[model samples]
Target: MKSLIVNADDLGRSAGIDAGIARAHREGIVTSATLMTNGPGAEGGGAVARENPDLGVGVHLVLTYGRPLSDPATVPSLVEPDGGFPVKASAVIGRGRVRTDEVLREYRAQLERARELIGREPTHVDTHHWVQEEPGVFTAFLELARESGLAARPLNDAERERLRAAGVRTPDRYVREFQHPRAIDVAALLALLELIAAAGDGATELMCHPGEPDPELERTSAYAVARPVELATLTDPAVRAKVRELGFQPITYGDL
Candidate 1:
């Protein structure tokens, strides 16, 4: 009845990031990861994952701040004219500039990129930047994975039927919106507990990013020093004990 999956996102973003995920999975609470198709150190991450088949690798469908799987010029609707996905999704959604058709095409390309590189359709699907959660992009993104007959995000018992109909896997929870710092107050942890509890019967994809609190990641991501905090949380004996106290057995996408 109590199951959880501690997942690391942005696996190929950097050596530092990838190494942190590897270590978290190897020695901490990390149970799965979503790979960035256009990420740096992608090849290295793939090699490591290949060697460690135990790691649950899924596609972190990217739609912003990175290279597109399709030519940017061709997939203009998916990115800015300059080839980057929009920096602010709200502005794009507000302006109605998001070309859903182009996005669909580009997402398909992202899927193919995952297959070509990782040697198979991803075991599961998650979006980079949580872009799939965006309004126009959400259902269409799910359709793309459904078309490929791959497992999609499963959130409930009724949805479990949906996934079963599509021959996909189903889980109850996902960790979206992870921008907060690790030095969270009681309110933050309480909020997280609330979110996790909302996912009634299925598994939860507990998303996190764990890395060193150093200039290397700081210069590149807003999550710089925060990575160490995440690592700390994963390695935190107290937090692990809490999972046990809450009765959530950790799991991954491959567990289905």
Candidate 2:
């Protein structure tokens, strides 16, 4: 039997985003969420998570365009002079402009802040824009997660071997299916399900960005109206019937 962990990212991005995430967890089939500590609706999301302890909460580590919780001076090397993390993290990853030690410090601070604000550290850490996959960045993230008692993104064969050597937990599931605004389609939804079915029978996590049908989402947030597909995937009797037919269990991050 296969166990699935479904997660919604960017939970604290906005009220619309927060409400959407909550509603999905309540009625629409979302099981877990990645909290954005510095997001606008962070406090509210944190409150909701506390209220609904069943909803698995994890850290959506941010290194992109958003205000940092820590003071710029406090995390000098992590943010731009304008006091925002880089919106385009890929551009500056190999530019030799950032100090790795300072980056690690800021990450630690962020982890601590998340624990303080949410009242607990995350069970897992996922990068924003997969920026942590960059050189040096992954090591920093791994080290922090190890220190904070959180898990990290899994790696390739050699790296996986190293993780085993270090006694780190490798993710059993991969969220290969994500709801990008541009990639929204019924076919994609079916493909996502197919991928989930194809993943080896073990703990698997499917991450998504499902939100309300709001034009403002496109204007303000990186999320699009993939809620239709996501909602459909959950509420559709056919999909629900399929879950039963396949005899799969939907778990959350905390369930891990």
Which candidate wins on TM-score? 2
Question: Candidate 2, which segments miss by more than 4 Å at Cα?
Answer: 155-164, 181-187, 214-216, 227-229
Worst 10 residues of 1 by lDDT: 181-190
TM-score for each of the candidates: 0.82, 0.86
Q: Write the per-residue lDDT of candidate 2 for residues 190-241, one digit (tens) a residue.
A: 5566677777587777667766666666686554556645655554555555
Give the Å error, residue 90, model 1.
Answer: 2.9
* Backbone atom clashes (below 3 Å) for every candidate: 2, 0
RMSD of each: 3.5, 2.6
